[model samples]
Target: MLDSLSLDEFGLWAWWIIAAVLGILELIVPGIFFIWLAAAAAVVALVAMAVDIPLTLQVALFAVLSVIAVWTSRRYFARHEVPSDHPLLNQRARTYVGRNYTLELAIRNGRGKIRIGDTLWLVEGPDLPAGATVHVTGVDDDVLKVEAVH
Candidate 1:
C-alpha cells in the first residue's frame, strides 16, 4: 500500500490529514489558536493539488500563512475588544461598589462587617457605630472599602 502511493499524492494527503487533525484538536482544546494553523494547512493542500510544489516550499508556505493568520487575529482582537456589561460578574466583591449597606458590626479602627446578599463582607473605612449606613467605594481583595453614608 505504501509503495502504491506517489510522493505528490502522499504530500497532498498528508496536508489534508494534518489540517483535519488540527481542526479536531481546536474543537477539543478550544483556544482559537489551532484553527488558524488548520486553515494554513488547508491552503497548502489546495496549492499542492494545483501545482507540484517541493516539500520545502509547501512547509514554508504553511509556516508563513500560519504566522500571518495568527498575527492578523491578534491585531483584530486587540483593536475590537468587546467590553462585558457585567465587568464585576466574577469579582463578587467589586460588584458591591456604589451600593449602600448598614454596618452589622461596629467599624472600630477602620474595620467592620456588612451583610450583602446573605454574605457578610469585611469592610475598611472610618470608625462608625454598628447601625450606621456605609457606602461601598471599592473592593480590595476579599475586603470592601467603604465610606460613611452621611
Candidate 2:
C-alpha cells in the first residue's frame, strides 16, 4: 500500500508519522520536551508538502525549528510560572515543617529519629528522650530540624 505513494508523498507521510510518535512520547515520558520535536516534524512535513526540498534541508529545518520551539517555550514558562495548589508536593520534608511529632528515638548528641507514617525520618535538635513531643522547625538536606514543644 505504501508503494503506491511517490517518494515525495512518502517523505511527507514519514515526517507526519515521526511527529505523531514524538507527540506520543511526550505523553509517556513528560519533561516539557519532545512536543517541540513533534511540532518541528509536523512543520517540516507541511513545508515538504508545499515545496520540494532535499532531505538534508528538511532535517536541518526540523532541527532549527525544534531548538527554537523548545527555547521559546522554556523562556515563556520561566517568566510565567504555573501556580500549583501544593507547592511543597515534591518537597515532602519541607512540608513537615511546623508540624509536631513525638520523637521515636532519643536526641542523643543532637541526632534522633521521628516516625511519619511508615517512614522514620532523621531529625536534628537538642537532647530529648523518646516520646518527647517536638515541633518541626525546618529541613536541612534530608534531616528535619526540630525543637522541644515546651
Candidate 3:
C-alpha cells in the first residue's frame, strides 16, 4: 500500500496527518497554542495538494504561516484582556491596603505583629506601644508595611 503512491502524494498525506495530530494536541492542552500550528499544517497540506511544490517550499510555508498566526493571536489577546470580578482574589496582603487595624504587639525596631482574623501577620512600621492603631500602607513580600494611624 505504501509503495503505490509517489513521494509528493506521501508528503501531502503526511501533512494532513500532522495537522490532525496538532489539532488533537490542542484539545488536550490548556491554551490556544497548538491550534495555530494545526491550521498552518492544514494550509500547507491544501497548498501541496493544489501545487507541485517541493518539500522545502512546503516546510517554509508552514513556518511563515505559523509565525503570523501566533503573533496575530498574541497581539489580539493583549489588546483585549478579560476583566476579573475579584481583582485581589489571590493577593491576601494587597487586600489589607488602606485598611486600619489595632496593633496587638508593640513595634520595636520597625518590626511587629498584628492579628487579622485567625492569622498573625508580621508588620513593619514606626516604633509604637501596644494597642496603637496602624494603617496598612502596602505589602512588602510576606510582611505588611504599616504606618501610625494619626
Best by lDDT: 2
Give one digit per residue, the lDDT tens place, for model 3 in 6-74.
546666798899899999999999999999999999999999899988998999999999999999999
Report the alpha-carbon TM-score of model 2 versus the true structure: 0.82
**What is the alpha-carbon lDDT for the whole of candidate 1?**
0.92
**Higher-ranked by TM-score: 1 or 3:** 1
Clash number for every model? 0, 0, 0
lDDT of each: 0.92, 0.94, 0.92
Q: What is the TM-score of each candidate against the true structure?
A: 0.72, 0.82, 0.64
Which clashing pairs does model 3 show?
A: none
Distance from true location, Cα of 80 in model 2, Å = 2.7
Cα deviation of 141, candidate 2, in Å: 1.0
* Residue-wise C-alpha lDDT for candidate 2, range 52-119, written one tens digit per residue: 88988998999999999999999999999999898998899998999999999999999999999999
Candidate with the greatest TM-score versus the true structure:
2
In terms of lDDT, the poorest run of 10 residues in model 2 is 2-11
